[model samples]
Target chain A: MSKRKLTIAVTGLNNTDNPGPGIPVIRGLRDSEEFEVRIIGLAYENLEPGIYMHDIVDKTYQIPYPSAGTEVLLARLEYINSIEKIDVLIPNFDAELNTFMRSADKLKKMGIRTFLPTLEQYEERHKSVLPEYGEKYDVRVPKSKAIFNASDIYSLNDDFTYPVMVKGKFYDAFIAYNTEQVKMHFNKISSKWGLPVIIQEFVKGVEVNVVALGDGKGNVVGAVPMRKQFITDKGKAWAGITLKDDKMLEQTQKIFSATKWRGGMELELIKTNDGKYYLIEINPRLPAWVYLAVGAGQNLPEALVKLALGEDVKPYENYQVGKLFIRYSYDLICDIAEFEQLSTFGEL
Target chain B: MNINRNIAISDTGFVFDPSSGDSYSLNPVGTEIIQLLKKQKTIEEIQVEIVSKYEVDDVQLEKDIIDFILTLEQYNLIENNE
Candidate 1:
């Protein structure tokens, strides 16, 4: 008997970050000859579809923005349902999480598996709750508070120092210094996003991103650490390298156990001069750049797919460490632009 | 914070930290900050130059410059200049 075709749909594939990490995860599944993959997003047309080498996607789907609570989402979801046997649904962008999470019941009724942490887990892992968890892992997460009204944020503890950052309950951040300054920023951001707002400690250090794969049984199957070699204007890490930091790995495992995390995740860590790495936030989905974990030899989406279908998951073994992958242009241009000071940024 | 170190970078934007065997790459502003620091510009001085070059504000620039210079120093990218 021929192998049954397993279909997966990835939302938010249109991000312009070059050599997108998602490609590798898709490739791992397609190349394994076990699954059929389809990438769903408006990426190549609406966004800069920078050169990519992953040829696994059987088809790419594009949908318009303002998707949630609107025709776009319904249309897209309808299109998705039209396609049979979409066993796994991976929501890639943070912005899309709200729609899918809010609409979870409906999707689950359709027999689609959501690749998110539980709702309760999401609440805890969000900006408001992660800091407390950060303390457990010795990760320096930004200090913040959750606010219902923008006015309440104004009269915060006057003892609060300068340079605090105000952010959404999720990923977006708006940096503010003084109270009055934050008030002005408050209006600007209020018009853009709805609260509860998170006020966090503005911790600074070299950003180190850790991507790990978790078996559905709550064990960290694989993990990789990469320092922020370069970041885009939108806070995307443009250029980075895979590292072999056992210390970071241990702390990551500690946090994973503490959170009872049971899926693929990305942790943003900051390294202080005192040789401490502080946790910033935890991402519950396979990040766009998840392929780095693949480059490092832990293919998450496939592992999760296998685990979800009740198949025996192969244990992840240690692989060659210290492998580096760079974007075709961003890392290169950023390097040429700053070559004069290469002595400092160049040291690795 | 002064970028009191000679930096070598790859065309692919790989920042090799010879001091700690660690490497970093810079975004556009990160690249600018490292350059101005290499010219021995003070944090405040570099902030002014950077603001004229990017959309970031003085408050952010101030904190970013100080924190970034410290980050460079922490990674042994540089320390106090003579």
Candidate 2:
């Protein structure tokens, strides 16, 4: 009788509020009865060592996260192999997407479901990559250039505008208000982070992000266009309002199709001073504001779980567009502390 | 660290003072830093003090204290005594 029910492994279960932006996915998975869920983590801070959260999980297992090269992901794969079976591998962090993307072929061979966007798709949505694609779509993106070296940056004079963005290939991003500032930032980051820096034109406007879940069959099932009011410590949008506009929703679909992307995606759109919508970057996974998507009406996690199990994907009723969500709780108090990481006594 | 006596709290995290139309989040660190700020420690003073006392680095400590106070000022947590 139990053989038919799916056993999904919810990895990175950090039993804390600072669990990046992935906590809501766990909550949504737990709320659904379709999947028999078990939580796997590196440690259980919520309980005594070797003891897991009995209330939230059917069973919990401890696997040490590896610090060495490929050890962490390998440890995760080994844990996956130990499981009865896996239906899906949901990456909870944008940083994890890189590793998860590389592991896609292996997971597919193992008969597990992993929804990773393609390299082209990733390039289509990345902040540095958006401007190039924006040209074809007639979508205005920040004036940008991908530099191969530090000298390429130093060669720039007053020809470039003030207040440009210094974007990293990975996580770290910064703003440079002048040539000296840009060079100073470049000097610091180029040595520390390695090469291929992106210098982008800065646009001043309201920052809006679009969250959408898509199936592999070229179908986008759930979506929300939102104006982010604040971002929490883990880069999660702490508070935002969903936009109620069919035009924005339609345009979002246009951008996805233009990119020929699959899986879940979020696009950061900057409305310029000229009333033009410029696609700044695309996050090929859930945004920090996904919980707000649930509040707005579409439960993307539930939809994603169903799709991963090889079940017939269902249509998602469009969620209310103008709903607002603000993350505030006893847990946030803890999350913000660890996140701010300010130099202060009693503030770590 | 002593907090300014007049800081008012709101349920939605909307902190304010009627004297000026300023707002802020006692966003955990903000809560802790405000306690320190009321002691009237300068930014560098707080950074040096925190690094010596806490389990953080010089760079991180400076960034955190400066950002925390800046956020405080943004939300009007630090007001004009004038």
Candidate 3:
């Protein structure tokens, strides 16, 4: 039987050691039995590996960075959509999601559907405001504070003990053992991801994760909990296994029901020795290891696209408990002309 | 005692739990106990077998076996049928 064809424009194509979710998301879409996808690789840089992955990405286009603002991004998308006639656009970067979320309506008017969290939903789950989100939603979150300056770092001692996690607004996290280390991390993080660095209490436990999708109607489309079997130094999962964790699944359903979250979300959680789960961070999109969920029986990206198209999707009841996904690096040999094409023409 | 039926013990003492996808490496004695448990050997039977083969006394070995069983239970290698 012939499947429905979808042209999905996806960003975050840099499939490096510190990988992005684009390649994985694309992989999930390609694996869709229901939809035959013509993947439009939306890249910010010329050298994003997914652009060169010919078998994966049908075509690649350069888009303006999110820092260029929503108008500029929408204009670039307008041009891309004119040619490709993209059905759905999935922005996979945390930094770029705000721009996409803001322009979601404009893109819809331009006939580009996107399933993304609302701006309010996005801001409420930000690292700085996680404590409040946890409190409002009845989730167990680590004690944390958002500090703007170095003076605030000194005062953190009054509220927090040593060995707190100093984190950037968007990325980069370090364990600071002293006030001096906190100040150093504060400067480092602020310099990179801007001000209002977050300092969270260090929760000692094994890191587990869940990739889930919500239909924007307080319904869980799918949820797959996983435990990392191997981790990279950059803290990305090299290999992970799907778990039969009912508690984690219940927590994910609770959060989705509470927030009525739209699109995909990854819950970073810490499972303590006493079996209590602590919500560490919530990535407002599907994670790099999302393909594991696909392997486990829940095709979240497929469900997300269905939701974006306003289709009623049945919630997945179960996934293969012990399905494992091990990611490996492959060296793709591409000619320099392909690089020159993307660099000079901004499309390939 | 109900050991997880999905647990697979390799000769090299590597234990893999299919249910949880958790793996553990056991020492020789630990491997022996797991192998014995897989056969539905009771704790007293395991204690008697280990005491006869090894130099350790029955009383001390019994205590050690119980401690090891507790650790196995903690790791979810065995079901809490108690």
Candidate 4:
């Protein structure tokens, strides 16, 4: 008897200077020995390098951007599903997750499965709500406020001080040393990513991240903590090493149990010089550095697929500590004709 | 106005500058304009070619070309020797 081959569609395939988690997630899926997989790359733009990585992605389809609304996205997915019969979809982008989560029921009706956090779980973990989330979860989070207007920067003195962090709702963050910088970043980020720019107290510490998976039943299936060894100018981890930290592991479990979170999550925490971990952000999806967890010993993407398939998976007890992941860039040689084909046909 | 000779502009709109090790992506129209620029085509000639092929007017095309050129210059892909 042979195992059934699963066709898994994945998004966020933009592997560039700022990479996405799709390629690494696909790598994890392909590395799974328990099941075979056929990968369908769901991309937003025709030029996303992962679309050209034929060795990893079986087929690539350019879907409409999330700004096109869920109906457009669902229509595109329906057409794609009619051809590929995608059994599971792993959406890795923060912006696209909302559309997918909202359409999860409809997608499930079409026989496509996705393991993701509930809308409530997703909303409560947003950067602007981190303070309340920390209070509710008994976690230590830096004081933060969401400001809709740049004028609100003048009033931040009530709760915030100089050199605070100004963050966009969806992306981008800057350390604002004064009210002018705060107003500048607020306008810049809000114009690009929309209103409700977040202002947070700057925690002076080293940043550590934990990638964990929960079963939606208070059980953390897998967790891996890593300290960023080298950070890029864009604040991305250029190199990271897995750590043997019980405190971080406990924090991950606490969040999972409290939220009964489903699917993959990356908890960004700042460890203060006083040896206390302050929660920074909770990315509702897997981090770009997820391959580090797969390398360290836990194949989380594979486990997530199994969980999505309704299989009972046991919790992973341990991972190899001190495992290092050094990120590198490779220029894939591809012809112009391929890009032209995808650009014209919207599929490759 | 000139494009940096070291800048490689592929048909796919992928741009790479060897000196800076910076890579960029462009839309199809942007790629076509860069290719024309590489051939030393004047802005007027490029505009005429684009307006003929694209469903755009001269005024809009001229405005877009200027904006695109400004973007290219911002990325250090263009050099103004004059």
Clashing pairs in 3: none
Cα deviation of A273 in candidate 2 (Å)?
4.5
DockQ per model, Cα: 0.05, 0.02, 0.48, 0.01
Candidates' chain A TM-scores: 0.77, 0.79, 0.98, 0.98
Clashes of 4: 0
What DockQ results for candidate 2?
Answer: 0.02
Of candidates 2 and 1, the better by lDDT:
1
- Candidate 1 Cα misplacement greater than 4 A, ranges: A1-4, A17-24, A31-56, A60-79, A98-111, A132-142, A152-157, A328-348, B1-82
Model 2, docking class:
incorrect
lDDT of 1 by residue, A11-66 (tens): 55443543344454565566554565554322323232311223445444444454
Candidate 4 Cα outliers beyond 4 Å, as residue runs = A1-3, B1-82
- Number of the top DockQ candidate: 3
Interface RMSD, per-candidate values to 1 decimal: 4.8, 12.5, 2.1, 15.0
User: TM-score of B chain for each model?
Assistant: 0.77, 0.57, 0.90, 0.92
**What C-alpha lDDT values do all the predictions have?**
0.63, 0.62, 0.91, 0.90
- Candidate 1 residue lDDT tens string, B1-82: 4443434555455666532237688876777767776677877788778778779878977987778777877667777764
| Ordered list by lDDT, greatest first | 3, 4, 1, 2
* TM-score to true structure, per model: 0.67, 0.66, 0.92, 0.80
Q: For residues A179-276, could you state the per-residue lDDT of candidate 2 as single tens digits?
A: 77877777776775556677888788767778888776566777877877676554446677776545567777776666556677777777654446
| TM-score of chain B as predicted in candidate 1 | 0.77
- Between prediction 3 and prediction 4, the one with superior TM-score is 3
lDDT tens digits, residue span A1-348, model 4: 566699999998998767889999999999888878999999998878899999999999999999999999999999999999999999999989999999999999999999999999999999988889999999999999999887788899988878999998878889999998898888899999997899999999878999999999999999999888888877888888787677899999988999999999999999876669999999999888999999989999999999988899999998877678998888889889998889999999
Best by lDDT: 3
